[model samples]
Target: MGNRILIVDDEWNMRNLIKIYLSREAFQLNEAKDGYEAIEMADQYAFDLVVLDVMLPDIDGWEVCSTIRKTSEIPILMLTARDDVKDRVLGLNIGADDYLIKPFAPEELVARVKALLRRRKKDNREIDKLLITFNDLSIDYDSRETWVKGTRVELTPKEFDILYTVAHNPKTVFTRDILLDKIWYSEEFRDLRAVDTHVKNLREKVRKAGLSFNPVKTVWGVGYKFNRPEDQY
Candidate 1:
């Protein structure tokens, strides 16, 4: 079966246009007209990607994206009439994978969708052989699971990817741009602050899980790295 994609937009013409283009590319498509329907449908189905519009009737796209980021890592491409930089940065920080302004070419949208799906597949392949353990931290790439102090830790998809990447490359500093390129390769307009936001969220979750030490550390005037306790000692 081809990749399943959900298109969420209040405009019938927009949905139809996206369906027409994506259907030609062999993607299985579904449509939702509102944010509420979008969230409900997402919970009920396993969609590979969501093409979401920012201005929804009920819940806005940013809220929907944030809500989804709490549980799933399904890629999201945000559509908006507003092309403001802050709006784009806000969407990215809230977990939208990619953003497209309205009045966009359908061809460009299709290309972005293809690139996101392709990057997702590549990321999966790269993590297939990974199983990293350091002190109380444990990550199993095959299962997409993480544990701290022998207790399971819940992480969003991006959180897990960032943690796993840094953990695997212990002691190696990764700049914000580097991490963005490595993880969100298809998003060319992402904010560097998004990296800091995810790291902060990841650390808070770990701390809330009763872990005393944070494995991810900041390198002064540089970026971040994962340092094993033994290595630091």
Candidate 2:
């Protein structure tokens, strides 16, 4: 079955708004109004994800998120009317795995949901347990270990994030800005060199593993993709 998700908000329209789009897809959906009812419904059933609104009459979303995190590791994405950077940081500090400010595109909402699920699915396994194998190379996210055939490789945290992002979506080209945005969450990310630095590091690491280092391919004026010669087959 697809994941069941809970949407908690005091406004009926807001709750139903998300539900309408989500239900059109494959997710099993449920809703609760106010923080008290939200907690009650959450306790009543197991949920794969929680979409919470910040404003509630009975209580705030931050407290509800804190309470949920105290007992469970279920992924949470918070909804807020505030677009302030401080508000976003606060939500992340409080336990929201992700956040969306008001007036976001439904397509973006769906994309964020899918990204979170993909991240969770990839992260839930032990590094030694989940090896991403293609051609002669492999990467283990759980252990932060990578290899070409049987030889080991070393990677920095940023390099690993870069590698992991492309590896998860092999053959999908990414622009420099796309890679930077995906790997880092800096609000003031004007220095574009960070992406270049990480890509250089990742390429060297793959080479050090005794492999041909042909996996991470550049797209000329575009960005790059983690692809092998056999990816076309």
Candidate 3:
């Protein structure tokens, strides 16, 4: 079967237009007119991507994106009439994979959709062989599982990726922008603070797992790097 995509927008004409453009690509398309319906559809179905509009009758797209990120890493392509830099950064920080301003070309939207799906496929393949360990911190990429001090640690998908990326390259300093590029893969706009948020969550989770040390360290004015006690030797 072709890729499944959900289009969430309050405007019928907009949804129809997107459907028309994507119909030529063999996608199994679904539509939701409001954020409420979007969430319901997302919960009930496994979509390859979601084209979400910022304005909705119920919850806004940012809220929907944040809520979805809480449970799923399904790629989101956000649409908005606002082209402000802050809005774009906010969307990316909240977990939208790509952002398109309203009045965008249909061709551009299709291209972005294709790119996101392609990246997702590549990422899945990469994760299958990923296993990184630093001292007592261990991460299994395929299962998206992490352990610190031999105890399981729960993490959001983004958090796990951030941890794995830094830990896999221990002692290597990764600026926030570099981390975003490596993980998010869309660099049109940058959100350095988002990296900090995930790192904070990762550290808290590891701490709660009874681990006595932090594997991730800030470089102060640079970025972040992973280090272990034995790395000192």
Candidate 4:
């Protein structure tokens, strides 16, 4: 079966339009008219991607996206009528993977959807096969879980991906741009600070969870790498 995608929009015409275009790609599609429905459906079903409209009659897209991020890492393509850079940045910051302004070309929409899906597949394919353990930190790629000293640490999807990517390639430096490509899969959002923010949050979480060592080490002039306790200064 093809990938299952949920299309969330309040407009009947918009939902039908997205379905029409996505149908050509042979994706299995589902629909929700408002934020509550979207959240409920997301919890009840396993979907590969979500095409979410920012404006809704109920909870709005940002809230829905934030709620979903609490539980799942499914790719989200945010649709908005506003083309402001602030809006786009807000979407990305709130965990939306991709952004598309309203009145966008049909082909662009299709392209962005395909791109996000491709990124998701590539992430799955590149996950480390073995469980990664360093010091008291343990990361299980298959289970998408992290543990510090036997206590499970709650990490957001992005935080988990960043931790896994660096930890899997121990001692290898990954520049901000590289991580952005690997995780966000888009060059449009050029704020390298986003990567820094996630790494900082990750470190704090691991520390708060009782981990004795910091696994993610920054190289000062360069990017970040996974360093064993003995290797750090």
- Local accuracy of candidate 1 as per-residue lDDT tens digits, 1-233: 99999999999999999899899999999999999899999999999999999999998999999988888999999999998999999999999999999899879999999999998898766755487877777899878898988899999887898898998888689998889888886856688898999999999998888766787898878899996776565
Which digits, one per residue and each the tens of the lDDT, describe model 3 over residues 56-144? Answer: 99899999999888889999999999879999999999999999989999899999999999999998767644977666777897778
TM-score of each: 0.58, 0.54, 0.58, 0.58
RMSD of each: 14.5, 12.2, 14.1, 13.5
* Candidate-wise lDDT, in order: 0.90, 0.82, 0.90, 0.92
Q: Which ten residues in a row have the lowest lDDT in candidate 2?
A: 122-131
lDDT (10s digit) by residue, model 2, range 125-214: 644345677767777876877777788777788788788788888868999888777777777564567787778878877777667546
Score candidate 3 by TM-score against the native: 0.58
**Candidate 3 error regions (>4 Å):** 131-233
- Deviation from native of the Cα of residue 86 in model 1, angstroms: 1.1
Off by over 4 Å in 2: 127-233
Clashes (N, CA, C under 3 Å) per candidate: 0, 0, 0, 0
Ten-residue region with minimum lDDT total, candidate 1: 124-133
Q: Candidate 3: deviation at residue 16, Å?
A: 0.4
Predicted structure 4, TM vs. truth: 0.58
Better of 3 and 4 by lDDT: 4
Q: In model 2, what lDDT does residue 44 have? A: 77
For this target, which candidate reaches the highest lDDT against the unseen true structure?
Answer: 4
Candidate 4 regions with alpha-carbon error over 4 angstroms: 128-233
